[model samples]
Target chain A: MKKIINKPEDYLKEMLEGIYIAHSDQVTCVNNDLQCYVTKTKKEGKVGIATGGGSGHLPLFLGYVGDGMLDGCSVGDVFQSPSADQMLAITKEIDSGAGVLYIYGNYNGDIFNFDMASEMADFEEGIRVETVLGADDVASAGPSEPGEKSTRRGVAGIFFVYKCAGAAADQMLDLDNVKRIAQKAADNVRTMGVALTPCIVPRVGKAGFSIGEDEMEIGMGIHGESGIRRGKIEPADQIVDEMLTQIIEDLPYNKNDEVAVLVNGLGATPLDEQYIVVRRINQKLETAGITAVKYYVGEYATALEMAGFSISLLKLDDELKELIKHPVNTPFFKQ
Target chain B: MKKIINKPEDYLKEMLEGIYIAHSDQVTCVNNDLQCYVTKTKKEGKVGIATGGGSGHLPLFLGYVGDGMLDGCSVGDVFQSPSADQMLAITKEIDSGAGVLYIYGNYNGDIFNFDMASEMADFEEGIRVETVLGADDVASAGPSEPGEKSTRRGVAGIFFVYKCAGAAADQMLDLDNVKRIAQKAADNVRTMGVALTPCIVPRVGKAGFSIGEDEMEIGMGIHGESGIRRGKIEPADQIVDEMLTQIIEDLPYNKNDEVAVLVNGLGATPLDEQYIVVRRINQKLETAGITAVKYYVGEYATALEMAGFSISLLKLDDELKELIKHPVNTPFFKQ
Candidate 1:
């Protein structure tokens, strides 16, 4: 593969090392540690927020750790789960007398590891751990009442879950209050993405799936899951229309409900394309009478060199609105 | 081209529309205009800051417009310059009776267009425009006396010049004061980059130059200027060591001088790789007895889908340090 890397196996280690050196002000490796990293300047006395998952998704787990963001993150290898030890260690490092909140996307390995870590923390130390799983991918499961809470693959909508929960934590809300807001953010959020090109994993030189130059897959997962539909490439407006149509109808978003829209580029897609998608999303929301009062269009979450984008809508109430609008400063996210 | 775009030629227009829609809270189009976009949330009574150049490099021109950044940006087509008319119009719009400070990368087309705009503004509108040309790319020209203020391509170091100047303007500094600080930032900064792969321009749909799968070019320009050397792709630390060796000696960055380090990804390179490079950079700086106080590693400046990274260092004095540390919030940059 034509990558700017020395070795495929060393990719994860090198990446974490880079994050440590590059963002020393916002984060630090736990005791020169790469597996677990915590925010250097976290808000004190708040319910410490933590999130983590497999590597390769830049800024997802580790990037959101600073002022008004996560307190710590436990990172795994590419597409592999971090050990329970790693998670427990980071959890202990970030716990500030007020318990810890582990908010992550609902993936099998992640669920197992985080659960194990929480149990380990409870047994080894008397630290309380509250969990809020991200299950916002609309294509992962059929929507039942209150929306399918389980088995739904969490995707880019984790951005909202982390942000709202982190904001609440920044405000020194208790563990219960932070968990409540985080769950609300998850329930109110829905996301779907389309991929124009396949991403090449560093270890594997070939793509997971072959895609034609003139086609795209709608509802593509960050892990490059076979999407719901594949068809010829469409204009920005058409793509946004189809994706938003599904997301809006799935939630049955009310005519005048408020939302914060995230147009996230999956790695190699340019910011220009993201904005075009956002422009169309704005028009669609207007037509649907949904007030998109806040918009974040950029590379919030990314798959390695994947050429596509995911549009995530977090239907907002007044509390979520205040949390979303709260000032945040981190290496990857600043608002 | 395997891009999620409607037409290659329409990229710039669509991007501006996206930015206008996404950042409505911070910026507005020049009355439904794509060529000129101005900040809606600029600090009044401050010297209005403006920067513009060719499109393709996101967040450089338009993304840096808001409360603590540029007041306006005159956009161009992909890899092409914006017209003098656009610059003059934005210059007029961002003028807050404190005159306008024009800060941009030192590219030929940008220099010509901005010079023409300033001339037109003087003759036609009687607006005083002071410009701080960004010439921080060390490889662009030989380092002569007084730091070769002219004949250097701006590259990523322009981020600091705009940032410090914008911060000074936010402090309500007069036009001359802002210009002075911006110039200081430009002179104190230097950058060098290497490209592992070439960028595919949308208009062309083909790369300008191609490197061997295992080969890399050191000191390559953002526009793909040929570098000082090319060889097998080495490990991240080795590459950073060589790059910093050149940069440190160029300015002869003293033992105790404070500076800011920016590791900029040229579009398609992964953040993980960028961090690995930063790790080596920190090691080298410490060995050289230089103090790196602030670190920014991400895609601050990017070429279209190019897999490479640039390292920029800004030698900071007390005034420049204060300006850089000043709080500023924009759609793309917050510090």
Candidate 2:
């Protein structure tokens, strides 16, 4: 694994400095550390939006922070959640008079740490905090059956939640409203991903998992969690159908129900393959009598260079539609 | 080499259908073929913006088209430029009474085909066409010497040109002014890239190039062009030094000059490594006494899972700064 770095230890610091230099106008590093980039403008009445997660997913946490998206982002080490202290500091820094909203993915460490930070903000800092955890990946646990609690895992679909929440904030919605809208978006969303290969974490120095050249793991987690099933690499149409079937069945979207569809390539899948998946997914949606109101087919969220994709569907209504359509200005997503 | 596709040939069409469904409110596929997604409400007086390149590089061309960025994008095969006829159809369909501006990366096929389409548009449809070729990869081509032509290649730095040009178009600038702003943005930019590993095109189903696990290629092209030199993967600081030294010397930006910087991950490099690269790049910029006015670090333009990264600099002026800062609403870039 040849890489460009002074020492593996210095990787995080160097990267933060570069991000700050690039987005200096819209953001600045807090405490001169690359852990957080807070927006420059502090609107008195706007709810401060803060997002955080692992490092590899760019334009998700950092790039999405700007005028119309996240107010700040707490970046952790690769695939690790930021410390509660770090999230606390960022929350304080970006907090306006109104309140602060925490939008993050539903990972174990993230949930635990962010919850602690939220409590600290309320009791110690006198700041109100609201959170909306994005748990769109359907393969995280399983269906919510009698014994299955459906352990929620956050994946690329968090980007959509950020967009919607940011739009709500941009519209001067309060923290409660923002959290509600974000949660609504999250609840209506379900995603399932497949992986052809595993990614090598810089620290790990080897692939997180192993997949044979002829096989793929379906419902793989971004952090390389064991997926629901493994099978031979099949045609794109079959692969997409399997992924979308799980998502559609889980969400139980019905005829005339509008939805936003996202077919995301997990880093390594060529756009050509992703597009092919999207085409098949579209045909499936039409056949199922579902109306895809909005569709995004690209690498919105990725798992390093894992050569596969995921399908995300966000069931939409009038309000969700308006929120999804709301204007946003961020480095990664704009609409 | 596992992949998900029933037929490689139908990849583009399927992906375009999915994209159109997701963004139907803001974009739609022209001719029902999903080759081009034109804006739904292009103002009649504004210069129509059209961008297209290969498929894998997401948000680069497709995600950038919306309310304020591009009018439409004609997606080609992965890493391959769209055909001349496709370009011509996109130009013709997206024309909003005003002239159309074709903005794209400076690849050989893209240049030739887009040029042909522009000529056809002018001669056949009288839809006065102009073009701005993004040539920001400083390592690929040097500045033109006295009477000598530059072979500059466009890479991730094209995003800056897109923002600036899109802003100009949003302001309803005429075709000439739009072209001038775009060219100015392009002229002020420079980039250099290094690859840790080569990418594999889906159609080809092989690595674009071969590199040892312990080696890296410096000054590599987006499409795997031979780099200036290859060497063992060095430390992040040293790599940044090498990349920035050449770029700074080539552009010779003054101490007082302000610029926008982009530390772009070429597909496979994780965010951890990207941030490490960004850190060293910023430190070097500060050491050189250059003021980085703005910075973006992420996978803006990519080469399908190529394990590499690039650095881009756009020396900023008041006009360029304003344009860069202008509000942009697209699926990929919002600010």
lDDT of 1 at A299: 79
DockQ of candidate 2 against the true complex: 0.52
Model 2, residue A221: displacement in angstroms? 1.3
For candidate 1, give the docking quality class from DockQ: medium
lDDT tens readout by residue for model 2, B1-335? 46666656666666666566555667777777576667787687789989888787765778788777788788788777888888889899888778999888888888889999999999999999988888888777755687564588888888888889989999999989999999999888888999888876667877877888799888999889988999888887788898899888877577878888888877767665676776677777788888777667666887767878889888899999888878766655556
Please give the CA lDDT of all the candidate structures: 0.85, 0.80
Looking at candidate 2 chain A, the ten consecutive residues that score lowest on lDDT are A141-150
TM-score of 2: 0.87
Per-residue lDDT, model 1, residue A267, is 86
At residue B9, what lDDT does model 2 achieve? Answer: 66
Which regions in candidate 1 have their CA more than 4 angstroms from the true location? A41-45, A142-149, A204-206, B42-44, B142-149
Give the C-alpha lDDT of model 2: 0.80
DockQ by candidate, in order: 0.61, 0.52
Q: Poorest 10 consecutive residues of model 2 chain B by lDDT?
A: B15-24
Q: How well is candidate 1 docked (DockQ)?
A: 0.61
For every candidate, the chain B TM-score is 0.97, 0.95
